[model samples]
Target: MKMAARTKARHESLGLSLEDVVQMYRVMLQTRMIGERMMQLNRMGKAMFVGVADGHEAAEVGSAWCIRKGVDWCVPYYRDVGVALVLGQTAKDQFLGVFAKATDPNSGGRQIVNQFSDVKAKMLSGSVHIATQFPHAVGLALAAKIRKQDHIVVTYGGEGATSPGDFHEAMNFAAVHELPVVFVIENNQYAISTPVKLQMAVANVADRAAAYGMPGVIADGTDVLDVYEKTKQACDRARGGDGPTLVEVKCYRYRPHSSDDDDSRYRSKDELQAWLQKDPIDKAAAYLLQQAVAASRLEDMRQEIAADIEAAITAAENDPDPDPATLTRYVYGEDAE
Candidate 1:
C-alpha cells in the first residue's frame, strides 16, 4: 500500500523511506508491549521489579533509530528499553535481564534489569546513581575524538539528573573538547514521585545547554517523527564536529516510578488519562491506518510481536540463575598478572 501524501512528503523531506518509518512504528509498538508484559510478570511475582516505558517509547525509539547501532555508542538510562531494543538487543535479551537469569547478556543477572550493556552494539550499561552515565558517555566521545574516529555517542537521562554535579561536568568537558555526543533529557514531567515543577527552577531542561555553550532544542516526545527529525539534526551536527546538542523531549509518564511506587499519591487519574489520549503508539497506528495500511495488517503485526515476547519469556524462564560460586567474579577485580 502507498503512504498518504502528507506522510510520504514528511518522510521524503527527512530522507527516510516509507519502510523505515514503518519499522520505527513497529519498534515503538514492541517496546510498549514488552513493558506491559513485564508489568504483568512483576504482578505475578515472576520478576523482582519493572519500569514502565509506555509514554517514552517515541523519545527512546526515535532517538536510537537515528544512530548507527554498532558504529555509534549508546549510554542509556534505566528506562531505555526501546533504545536497547533498537541497538541490537532482542526481546529475549531483555526478558533474560529482567528475569535475572545467568544468560542475561548485560550482567549475568548481577545488575538491575535496565542496566544494559552490549560490547558489540557499543552500548554502555547504566548505573543506579543518576547522571553517572553522562561522564562515561563523555569519556567515550573523548576517546573517539582522540582516535580521530567518526563515532558519536548518544546518552539519555531524565531531567532530574540534570540537577546532579556530574551532568554539569560532563557537559562542560564535552563542549570544551568538542566531543561528538548527543545528550537527550527525557523529561517525562516527573522524577519518580516529584513533579517537574518541584525539581528545578528552570522551565525547560534544554535551557541549561546555554551554560555549556551548546545548542539546545525542544521536541514533543509524543510525536515520533518530530523526535526522529530533531535527533537526526543533533547527531549530524555532532558528526560534523560542531560538538554536543542537548535535546529536551517533553513527555508524560503513564506509570509509577517502578513496580514499587504508587503514582496516585502524587498524580491524579485524570492527568494520566489525559496523557493516554496522546499516546505515541495510538497516534502512530492511526497515522499508518490513514495511509492505506489495513487494520488487519497492523493486527497481524501485533500478534507476531506478542508471540515473540512470549517466546522470550519462555526461554528466560527456562534459564537458570547465576551460579553462587561466580557471584564475586565481576564485583571485584582479580589479582593482576
Candidate 2:
C-alpha cells in the first residue's frame, strides 16, 4: 500500500504522525457507529430519544483531541457523543445513558438520553436548554484562571445556539476576563428545522467573535485534519493566555434533528444528498485508504465496533433501572427533608 503524496504532505504539515491520524479515524468511526446504533434503538422503542452527531464527528472528535482529557474540561451540548467519546466516555457508558440505566453516569437515568456527564473525565453534564453550557464553560475557565491552573475549557454548541443570550454573555465575560476557553460551534446549518439563514444574518457564526474581542476561525467540519489543526491553534492560544476563540465548523447533519423531528418538510432531498457526498466518515476512510490502510482492515474495524456496541446494548438492557426508592437522592438536600 502506497501513501498518496498529498495525503502524506498534508498530515506531515499538521505535525500529526500517521499513527495519530489512524487513531483519530478510529474515534470518528466509533462515534458514528455509536450514534447509528442509538438511532436504531430509538426506532426499536428501546430508547426514548436520540440526537446524533452523524455528520459532526470530525468537529467533535478533532476539537476534543486537542484537550487533555482529565486535566482540561469539556462542557458539551447534548449532541456531543463524539466529544464525550474522545474525552473518555465509552460505548458502554453511552449505552447506559441511552437506556437510562441505574449505572448511567450522567444523571443516573434522571436526565434525557444523550445528556452526557462524567466527573472523572471533567465533562460537565449537559442540559436540554440550548447554549446553557456556555456559561458553565465560562465558569470553569474562570476557576482555572483564578487557581493559576494551566488547563483550558472547550465548550460546544450548535450554530443556532449563537442566537441565545447565554452564548453572548458567556463569550463577553470570557473575553473581558481573559478566561481560557474555546467556544466551538458545530454549525450543521440547521437548528432542528430552522436553517442557519433564518437564525442569523451573518454568513458565518464565527463572524460574531470579533465583537467579543477574540479570534474567530472557520474550519472544514468534514475534514478531520483541518478541524484538528484549527482547534489546536485555538486551544493553544487559550492556554497561552490569549483569551477565547469562537470556531464555527461548517458541517451538515445527515439525519433529522432528532428522533421526533421531520426534516423532509424543511430540507430538500437534493440538499441532503449533496451533504451526504461529503460524509465525514467516508472522507476519513478515503484518507486512510490513501495512507495505505487496507479496506479489509477498515471493515474489520467496523465489525469490532459493531460487536462492542452489541455487547454494550446487552449490558445496558440487563442493567437495572434507577430505583424508585432513591429517586430523590440527588435531587434534594438532606437538610431540606
Per-candidate local distance difference test? 0.91, 0.90
- lDDT of each residue in 155-208, candidate 1, tens digit only: 999988998999999999999999999999999999998889899888899889
Count clashing pairs, candidate 1: 0
**Model 2 whole-model lDDT (C-alpha atoms):** 0.90
Q: Candidate 1 has what TM-score? A: 0.95
Worst 10 residues of 1 by lDDT: 3-12
Runs of candidate 2 exceeding 4 Å displacement: 1-8, 333-337
For model 2, residues 1-337, the per-residue Cα lDDT tens digits are: 9865743457789888878888888889998899899899999998898888899999988888899978999999988889888888889999999988899989999899878788899988777899999999999999999999988999999998999999999999999999999999999999998999999988999999999888899999999999999999999999999899999999999889999989998999999899889988899899989888898988998899889989988988999999999888877656644
* RMSD of candidate 1 to true structure, Å: 2.7
